[model samples]
Target: SIPTSAGSESDAEQLQEEQHARSVLRETFLRCLLSISNKKVQFRMHEKVKVDATFGASDIDVLNFQVSDLHTPIGVQKEALIRCQDVISFTFDV
Candidate 1:
């Protein structure tokens, strides 16, 4: 049974690793969005503004996200709100 226990532990570790990777990918996406939104020039008005992101674990697990600017409005006061929403949505697979 020791070998079985070890296998279970390894599976847990792998899951943890995948979760961490996804978390990192989500964070990177949010940072990129913030940097882009902070640019001095205004984004094109009424543009579709689609953002696509993918996080994968080897060949099995994958998380894909596609968000439009219309769904997530970015502005001065809304920065934190937008980031929170994006992070939460990405983290929870929403």
Candidate 2:
């Protein structure tokens, strides 16, 4: 279904609210990452590929993951940065 535009003032207010909500969500996610730092976590990627690593940290923009001792099929990597976009999901023991 097609939607019509509201007044500029209303649109601006809505956009501001959306941005604020996104900011809050990002902050929460960062805090969660901090809690998981230095923990062993397994990332699940596409095609059912899974890799285990010692979680180090993440960039502010959540663009990449800093991990150590990454266990892949071919070999174990001493240190690597996993692209966040390639990860479908991940899990760790709390």
Candidate 3:
């Protein structure tokens, strides 16, 4: 039979590996955000609404994105914070 300590040790190792993976993913995402800063982006939101804006910055949690020169259906907004929940996707040119 396998020892209980052996199972616990493996569990701890797995947890550490998972944490490392998460850290890497978060770092990569943050880098992508940085690269997109100051670039023009097109956001596809709910109800098929789309808008163009200059990417500013994203909150640490990525819950919202700060933008500039937001061109909405109505008119242009000088600056805005777009909720991530409202956005289905966004794209920018490299």
Give the Cα lDDT of each candidate.
0.39, 0.94, 0.95
Give the alpha carbon lDDT tens digit for every residue of 1-94 in model 1: 3454446777889999999999999878675544443222222223444322232111112232222322324432312122222232222122
Per-model TM values vs. the true structure: 0.34, 0.78, 0.90
The candidate that achieves the highest lDDT relative to the unseen native structure: 3
For candidate 1, the per-residue lDDT at 25 reads: 93
Q: Please list the Cα RMSD from the true structure of every candidate, rounded to 1 decimal place.
A: 12.0, 5.2, 4.5
Tell me the tens digit of each residue's lDDT in model 3 across 30-87: 8999999999999999999989999999999889999999998899999999999999
Model number with the top TM-score: 3
Please report, as a residue range, the 10-residue window in candidate 3 with the lowest summed lDDT. Answer: 1-10
Identify the superior model by TM-score, candidate 1 or candidate 3: 3
True-structure RMSD for candidate 2: 5.2
Model 2 misplaced stretches (Cα beyond 4 Å) = 1-7
